[model samples]
Target: MPTHHEDELDYTPTPHNVTRARTRTAHLAAAWGHPALAPDVALVTSELTTNAILHGSLRGRLIRVRLAVVDTTLRLEVSDPRAERVPHPREASPAEQFGRGLALVGALCDDWGHGPRDGVGKTVWAEWKLPG
Candidate 1:
């Protein structure tokens, strides 16, 4: 039987940190014998990391990204230093320049939600079903 494991990586919210997070997720997915799920997971991580940097105020604060593989699901959680603002799916107009990240996340992910992390910031999480 294969054992399930959880992998976590924490980093500061910078413009270049997104790539690092994606790379870490990919490696972990491969290690867990789920190479096919890497792209989707990486994309989802990219969206969350981007949102954390863009909307969550990327000061000197750090962003934490966690990846876990359990059974047939892969979970991605990104935490940043802002708990005041919550994420919601909003209707985007043709002329709108923003507010499509969560929509894309919803379409790609099996399910997702946001909530406070401990006493600090908020964590945005999504899960992807692995293909057999």
Candidate 2:
């Protein structure tokens, strides 16, 4: 079995950091020999990090993103500072500009969930099964 591979980013909850997080996720995925999954992984990263910035943000707290390859799965996790702002997929109006991030995550990833982090807040994670 391949050794587990991991990478991480810690950033302030700024709008610009969402793009930065997406780019890093793509780079990590490609470096792990899963370039074909880069686009989808980037999309998921963008959605999750955007949520972290918008909903899970706490003053003076930073968001953390982790990317890992374990066995044949690619996993992405975003940790934020608000534990109460749990995420779920919900119906959105066609005219709505937001509210669809988790829906997109659900559509793209094989599995996704959220739970309390080691300390103050929560972490949202999604995983995709890698092709042989």
Which structure among the candidates has the greatest lDDT? Answer: 2
**Local distance difference test, candidate 2:** 0.94
Question: Which regions of candidate 1 deviate over 4 angstroms?
Answer: 1-3
* Residue 78 CA displacement from its true place in model 1, Å: 0.2
Global lDDT of model 1: 0.85
lDDT of 1 by residue, 58-95 (tens): 57778889998777778899998889877878999989
Segments in model 2 whose C-alpha atoms lie over 4 Å from true places: 1-3
How many residue pairs clash in all the candidates, one count each? 0, 0
Q: What is the lDDT of every predicted structure here?
A: 0.85, 0.94
| Each prediction's TM-score versus the true structure | 0.87, 0.95
